[model samples]
Target: MAGQRGTRVAGADLVDLLTRAQRALVRDLGTVLEEEGCTVDQWRVLRALAAEERSMGELAAALEIPHPTLTRVVDALVDSALLYRTQSEEDRRRVSVHVSPLGRTKLNRLESLAAAHERALATRIGPETVTRLTDLLRDLP
Candidate 1:
């Protein structure tokens, strides 16, 4: 059956719904990230670097971002002084990236914002449902 007066379709696939939900969620919760002057991809890099320094390849793999795309994001962050790159002492050809103090500060802010966003979502969807949804997402192929 369709929604309301049967004006909406009922056979939408999971992938379609998931993608639309993701876009909407991102749009809804992206305020903090924007205020920090960082894109979601850049925020991911910052979060990763907050843990420890990493090589470009390692970062790309960890974030599941394409190498070329990661390179552009890293370049922008580096230019913004949020991240810096250094050559490996043992392997001059290899370069590693680390988050600067500014990056860490921004990351902390973004983390707080993310927590609030999650809380608001939990309130909207119910905490138990959020947990179950998270578990389901994690288990997806």
Candidate 2:
């Protein structure tokens, strides 16, 4: 079934439906995250910083993100003290970011919220279908 622009209108595949849903989902989640005093970009930055210290370039690469935009997200997190960027002593030109205690706390809170949200969704959609959806999404190239 072709949609208005001749794109497939099928909803059986999760990706197409999910991609279309993201605009609204992002707005709703953005509102929720904002109410928690964070932005979507800030949340992503914090997640990236949580694993290990990374330079701006390294973080951008790990995120598959462009530099300048990611820099703005990093700047917000840095200024909030949720992340700290320190210059490498041996290489003054390079800087690395680490998550702070505050950042970890917030990230944990967000994780809990996400888990609860997932449970609720599973209840509505059936756990088996939800699990399949998650698996397919995880396997997507």
Candidate 3:
């Protein structure tokens, strides 16, 4: 049987729905990111580091990215001069990643583009519905 509009299917689960939504949203945002010479993962790393420097382990956990994959992403950003790594002052064995000034400039542009994309999405779907969905998603465990 076909699933009714705005209604869940009998076999559908929250994980499936969330995954599908995430993929679709990422694909849409990927286009904008591509124009800026960045990948979605790279964009995520930059965004996370914008607030403050973080250890690789901390970043991986906070971003929900695997350690190896996050390392590669960080490496690429470092090569681009968008990010830098430093030995931790508190722990000699630990290192922290930080966004560089160049990264901040790029992030500013990316943020504007992302905001425009979000606004477009809000216009397509009612803004109130988008706001409600965001609130609901944030409330989820």
lDDT of 2 by residue, 1-141 (tens): 346546644555666678776676566567667767887778777888888999999989887879999988888887888898899999999999999999899988776665666676678779999889789778977
Global lDDT of each candidate: 0.88, 0.80, 0.92
lDDT of 1 by residue, 35-61 (tens): 767787888899888989999999999
A best-first ranking of the candidates according to their lDDT comes to 3, 1, 2
TM-score of candidate 3 on Cα atoms, chains taken together:
0.90
Scored by TM-score, the top model is 3
Model 2: residues >4 Å from true position, as ranges? 1-18
Write out the backbone clash pairs for model 2. none
Model 3: residues with Cα > 4 Å off, grouped in runs: 2-12
Q: For residue 113, what is the lDDT in candidate 3?
A: 83
Q: Which lDDT tens digits does candidate 3 get at residues 99-131?
A: 999999999989988898899999999899899
Top lDDT model: 3
Candidate 2: residue 65 lDDT (0-100): 77
